[model samples]
Target: MVEKKYDVTIVGAGPAGCSAAFFLAKNGFKVLLADKTTFPRDKICGDGISSAALNILKEMEVLKKIESIDHHKIGYVKISSPNGRMMTGRYPIVKNFRDYGYVVKRKEFDYVLFEHVKALPNVHVLENFRVENLVYNKDKVTGVAGSHGEEKIDVFSDYIIGADGVHSKIAKKIGLFNDKNKHRAFAVRGYFEDVQDLSDAVEIHYDSQVMPGYCWIFPTGKTSANVGVGVFNRFNETKEAKELFDLFVRNNKYAKKKLKNAKMKGPLKGFPLTLGSFGSKRSSGNVLLIGDAASFIDPLTGEGIYYALLSGKFAAEAIKKGEPNRLAGEYYEKMWAKKFKNREFMPGYLLQTLMGSRIAINAAVFIGSVSKKRATNMAGVISHVLPKYKMIF
Candidate 1:
């Protein structure tokens, strides 16, 4: 058995885990950042990153690095309603953030972040480390026990930051995961080549069959795109993800026409989304959940990377306040609550439920089709460039 210790142990080296490790290591804290997979592993996603994520990438000095690589810049968005009405608009310009977004494969994006964090002096990077259990001192978490290949590893820390995805073992061990259908979703994605009429604008289709969810076509290159379909778990019980994906590509009018000549480059992959909901307990004892483990995904847009990165920043900030054993979890809870309060007070969960109704989707799309300003506003809200309150007001 290999024994290790650190000031903080972050499970899962995706965006959230990497962000936490980066910030903590920069602040001179020794951190053990572990992940089950190796670098450059493919993560199933729509591959669209908005301004919310860009703002932090800029702070991390990763934006410039990402720009140097091959990526598609998105300046506009197109929304198609269940009624077949479509509207297109530009991403609203926001202060302190870029007006446009980018689409890069998770395999590429996550690898860059992993490389950046590994170079830090106070960070130890562990690959292929699968956490199997949380070591608890009575009630409070003290460490984690997992396996690296055939070797057993036990890592102790003063605080545990669970940045792992939906099925986080730490969360389950701490009994914080809700696992309710209402707060969960599933999505399937595939890389497509020779997609006809690929554009810089990302496409979101709200077909009736996939109500409460949507289909996305995000361009990655001139002839290649990341195409997928996502559905709330509550409504996805009857069909497999692959079936929904097929239906979206062959039935949705615009998607059918655009994907007619496209060929899937690889097998379709699916992942579960732990959609964010208010009033959930995010922290207990010395463990705090961030990113998908904290359920930070947007209910309407299915966006998690931005919240994951943002929550990671908040977690590091809270831990830096001293007495992490006593105050870190409390600080994290309060900080994230205040920062994400908009989801409860604004049109976040409300809009998601309303969107499930065909009448609501059609009405909104019809209004957007007739009014360019309204279309822009809707796009802004969906892309998270503008607040949802602005659209309603």
Candidate 2:
């Protein structure tokens, strides 16, 4: 048995955990980043990165490394309705700047980020370690006990960060997993090869019949793309996701035509899409939750990578500046409220409304059709900041 102490012990080496380690280690804090899996592990994701996320990547200096791998410069977004209405918005790349977003393989992206963080002097990476329990003193967390291979290790840290994705053991152990307002969606996604007629724009098809959530086709290059559909799990309790996916691909015009002759290159996998924040009571004692452990995924689009990165940074910043007694919990709560609380709640509210009425969906589609700029603005409002819209007509 080996015992170690760190300023921060982060569970999960996904985007959020790695980003937190990167920022904290750069600031001279000792960080231990642990994950159950090794590098280049596949993650189930939409593989789309937004402009806001790109800015964070640039700041972290992993943008060049990402570019060296297999990626595609996404120039625009195509939103399609079931009734054949479509709208396209272009995100142009500025001079001396990379494009707004890129489609990347999570294996490569996570590996690059982990490598960068592991190179830091004050950081130690423990791979293939499963965190079994959190050692607590009364209500305050003091450390985590787990095993690396056949050896047992207990790591004591000033703070613990849980970035371990949707099924976070840390979150479950501390009684932070709540399903009160939690809307769970099941998504089946995979990569494909030899896909033709795919545009540079990421295409999203909204058809209520085949899939309640959106069907997305994101291009990674000329001959390959990431294609998938996300559906409300409650709707598929008795149904098979594969059957639904096949029916969707066979019947939908866009899916049928686009993936007509494409070959599925990888295994189709499913994962839980968590919606909304972890409430105001997510933090307890010295244990703080970030990323999926904190339920930071967007309810509407199911995009979480950006929120994950943002929350990770905020958590690391809190640990770096805040005092252990009074500031740890306060700092965690304040930072989450200031940065992500609104963004998480807005989409949940809007999705609830949209899910309740077809008229509302029609109205949304109508508004988007009337003005792409306004719709984009509306998306920005719900996803980033809420804006006041006064009807002129």
Candidate 3:
């Protein structure tokens, strides 16, 4: 097979890859976005996109398309403590900010991304093609070897991006996948139809039965919702995510109330969630990683799409600075850290640690209910609408 040359090659066609390709293409870089599966595929997630993620989509010029689809505009997150005490952290009305989040199926959300990126003149998208191996010259990644259907294709590029996801082949091949299981979280999500009392607010329940874990019900459509459960691996104790979600739905009181008339739209699906490890590495040689491949998911809310798009755009900006061949990984790492570490993940880690105790969660609910500003700030920080340091300093 002839090795085709391009300016940049990105693995994975999800939010990260597509965002990176779109930016790079607009900046006049010849880009290739490759993925193993076709669009409209499902990935296990909470299915909630914060307003920040939507703002990025607006910048990409695809927000209108997503808006035309059937989805719910989430305005706030309603929190129910283990003792059934409910409190809402409504997104504060920031001046000129779109004060709403979105809950759309990954099927529709990701398809819009793929279609938008594919229309770029300098961008080529390869679906159902997996990056089989990273082409390297003794640790310096030059490009990739991929399998599209039955044919093997070799593609060469000056820069490589591993946006493939948690099970990224590029990350593993580049020796970036250190097993930090303690830093990982596990979760399961599924769609349900005929759900009763489907509210515009995304509801999260913290039951004592699932300590260090929470169940979320996000309305995706008028009668359907995406329901899921999440538990930090540190306290997971070998419990199956699917079984845990089932038990929660059957047992949790508030869940029973809300889901009384709801029927499961599909079987519960589970997936591994990689968390951001502050001060951890995210690049090597001529390659940089983004999204789940770089463990950019928020530690508290599991909002990967926000970081995925941000990191992709940041990587493209860093690549734009590389004039004489390829950009070094350190530049990408530094850029990612400057933007996300102190500003994004630290507050998430703090809140995640605090939520470990049922008492702490109850206290938070009480305080947030009485103090509206504090509540909005806390909610804003978690939802990525406000800076994390707002809660700290």
List the candidates' TM-scores in order.
Answer: 0.96, 0.91, 0.96
Candidate 2, residue 37: Cα displacement in angstroms equals: 0.7
Show the colliding residue pairs in model 2: none
Put down candidate 1 lDDT per residue, 187-259, tens digits, no spaces. 9999999889988899989987776678999999998999999888765577777887888888888888888
What are the per-residue Cα lDDT tens digits for candidate 3 across 1-393? 767889999999999998999889989999999899988787778888898888888988889998998778988778888777887788877765677889988888899889989999999888888888988777667889989888999889999999999888888987887458766888888888888877778888888777679888899987788989998886676877777788889998877877888888777788888888786688887788999999999887888999999889988888887656455566787888888887677777887888888888888777777777877786677667788765433
RMSD in Å for all candidates: 1.6, 3.0, 1.6
* Best of the two (2, 3) by TM-score: 3
Off by over 4 Å in 2: 92-99, 233-239, 278-280, 324-326, 355-357, 375-393
**Candidate 3 to truth, TM:** 0.96
Which stretch of 10 consecutive residues in model 1 shows the poorest summed lDDT?
Answer: 339-348
Over 199-227, each residue of candidate 2 has an lDDT whose tens digit, in order, gives: 77788777655545567888988888888
Model 1, TM vs. native: 0.96
Quote the lDDT for 83 in model 3: 76
